[model samples]
Target: MPLHDFRSDTVTLPSPAMMAAIAAARLGDAARGDDPTVADLERCAREITGKDDALFVPSGTMANLAALLAHDCRGGEVIVEEAAHLYNSEGGGLSVVAGAVARPVKGRHGILAPASIEAAIRGSANPAVAPTRLVCLENTHNAAGGTVMPVETMAAIHDVARRAGIPVHLDGARLFNAAAHLEVPIGALCRPVDSLWFALCKGLGGPVGAILAGDAAFMRKARRAVRMLGGGMRQAGLIAAPALVALDDPYPAHRRDHALARRLACGLAAIDARLVDADRVQTNIVNCHVDDADDIARDLGARDVLTLSRGKNRIRFVTHSQVDEASVDAAVDALADILATRPNWSTPCRESLPT
Candidate 1:
């Protein structure tokens, strides 16, 4: 049997159609703005995001870094949720590359409260403190088991930022998942923020690239930032071609991935309800709590099942285009068997479960 890889959506390989599009791509020097395929991809991205302009970059990290650099000057502060990927997963690029400071605020399941956001904003006449430059939000927040932030919640945060004269940037790496879950157009979600980015390589199933979208002037600033960061490319349509196809209509794939994730979460709950809160499995990522995450991951790997250890006692499983319902079922069965055979395995008390 083939390995059941549930580590992340980034592991998904491009489909054959995507490969064909890549091969037939029309390429030119992207640095000079002549790559037709790249232009087409950016146009599609802009249309989908309801932004005035969009720029394709090498990775989600770079897209976010460009947005940060464009929105804030050196020594400026960026507000983010404590569990956001920007604060925890992006390798400090916001500070190291963009020369910005991160001010983290605790959020509930990755959604920042409007009051907390307002409180974190700094507007005093003191020069000692860094002025708040931007507010960053993650939709379908990765660290919080892919929880989707409601439109109302995002609007509230945006309103607070607007009143404080702070720009809002959305790290929407999995924005499609959030849109699918909410049954809303991606543009509806994008409207609240000043700028946002989404990954084509994640649930969209493109082999490479991400898009940063906003107004024309902001994108021009982001383009310069991309070049400054050594993110420019020549004949980049090889990657952009596939990304165009992925962006054309991603809802079907996103819907399937979300369904598979829920199925997997439900199955895991049946085996041991303490393992995961099925109600919290809102998108494509399922985070399960175990007594020993590393031990469980290693054991699952031995069975040709792969999952990522999030911490001391949490494992993450991400469903994508490459994983089907059958594969999800197989993974759930393997995990159920493993837990059943462990002599010391016991359901934890509800009060003791991690939130």
Candidate 2:
């Protein structure tokens, strides 16, 4: 029996073509600037993001952390959305590892308020306050059911940050998703920030890696920070080759996933389960509320369905390139069955942070 894996896109395996690319990759000493494949990937990413340079990192977390470290050089603070990956996920690496503070502002879903951003920046003005040096925004924000923050909002934040002389960094892990969902070019989605990073592993279908693109000078600094974090790779072309393949063959998993999410949302809504706003299903993620996620996840897992129980009862169902239309619909039907038969199911509850 096959397990319907709605756990996350990270579970996606590389395609046969990607494997061939990886196997045929030519290797060189990356530390000494001899890896031609990694070099090409970096160059390609720069061109894709319309940036002066790009640095290939082992993971999105490293790329984001390095970008932040480069942005807030003088032990400065970073303004970000309250539920951003940098704040909620990443294990507090920004504060503990990089010696930078994250000043989280209230935002709807993963969307940050420009007014809230302005207030946060102004609020950090006391003598003891850490200098606000950077603003980070996530598009197709993962925590917000993969919501797409519009380009105008991005422009407004960019304008505010520019006037304050603060650099803005975008944690564009699922940027391609944002671009596809908005029907905009990836470069247009990236025009608002000083630095941006995108992931190759998730949805892009690469086996491993992420890329951080920025101006030439900032990239030079980011390289040093990369070394500081021991991310300086050797023979990284092995990973870069596959990333090149994934990027070249763009797919509509973003839209398909969004549709799957809507199906899941409507299915659960029919059963009256505590759920996220169906209208906000913009990309691939579907965050739903269940009062007993542990038991529910276990129940589904026993039936060969996997999901991420974010909290005690909050679950995140993610559709990927691997989950075909049939699987998506089956998972929705499975959930409906769960809610229908389970004695504790069928009630909406208050939204609370996953415990």
Candidate 3:
């Protein structure tokens, strides 16, 4: 165990097959729709997600921005889980670029209750109220320690949105991990939503890129939105070629990451049950509660186990293709030793963790 980089799944290096595909790729103009490899990757994305069409984008954030713009929801409201990546992360692209406001609602462990959303939705009947135009959901929700939203829950939320005549968009950055955890076809999860995007980089192990998929008409609008955002890549097959290799067989890799995450979680719990709820981990991220989280993160880094401290007591560890069993054990042992050595390590978590 040299040094375990548990910072994020995005830290994963591209696989050999991915690099080879890039070198052997056939290229053309992607903005003009002539890149054969980009077309192939987009076709594959459409087939997997069961969408009428798909558009490749530079990043998941941009894909989400394109979806927001394409939905024609400017000056409207968007409902999302309070802990959703779209609200907390993404640098406020929803407001700055799409001119849509986010109305954050609370959810239990990152799974939204349909009733909560029903209560939050507003119509234009009152001038003071902004009409809710879209509802966003995240599968394998990030801030809740990678907790998963079940298909039944998704369908229920979609039903609520449908009754309100609001469209639903999924920010499925770790969609493959969710599908693997549920042991379902990826298309099954996409069936209920109006549109969604999934990253090829996280857990899928691509070097870069993501795919946004929706109905043919929506994609046409999204394509123009992508151009408006200056996301047009002339020869984007350079990015898509490697993403194709990621799609070759992503489930196995997703499962592997999940297994490692569980291992890390259970190991951390054994050191001290209060450190983490191992059972809460459904995918590749392990979040632990520790006093002085920044202090602990620094100590762990000095010992060669890299992890991120989120706020006062939360530390996030992501298992990716890069780490193995030895890496996990080393991390667990390092934490155990640190806690044992620290004088005031027994202090309970004081602040509430959001998400």
Please give, for residues 1-355, the per-residue lDDT of candidate 2 as tens digits.
6778989999998889989998999889887789999999988888888999898899999998898778764577888888889888999898888788888887887788777777777435587878888899998788777888999999999888887888889999899888888888789977888999999988787889899999988999999999999998999999999999988846565667667777777766666635556666788888877778877787778777899887775788887878876676677677767766776554445557421
CA error at residue 76 for candidate 1, angstroms: 2.2
Evaluate residue 171 in candidate 1 and report its C-alpha lDDT on the 0 to 100 scale. 94
In model 2, which runs have C-alpha deviations exceeding 4 angstroms? 123-125, 273-276, 343-348, 353-355
**Candidate 2's error at 256, in angstroms?**
3.2
Best by lDDT: 3
lDDT (Cα atoms) of all candidates against the true structure: 0.90, 0.82, 0.91
Model 1 CA lDDT for position 174:
97
Judge candidate 3 at residue 233 and give its lDDT.
Answer: 88
- TM-score, cand. 1: 0.97
Ranking by lDDT: 3, 1, 2
Q: Rank by TM-score, highest first.
A: 3, 1, 2
Residue-level lDDT of model 3, residues 241-332, one tens digit each, is 99999898789988999999999999999988888888889999998998888999999998899999988888999999999999999999
Q: CA shift at 47, candidate 2, in angstroms?
A: 1.0
lDDT of 1 by residue, 192-284 (tens): 999999988999999998999999888889989999988998999999999888877789889999999999999999988878899999899
Worst 10 residues of 2 by lDDT: 346-355
Which residue pairs clash in candidate 3? none
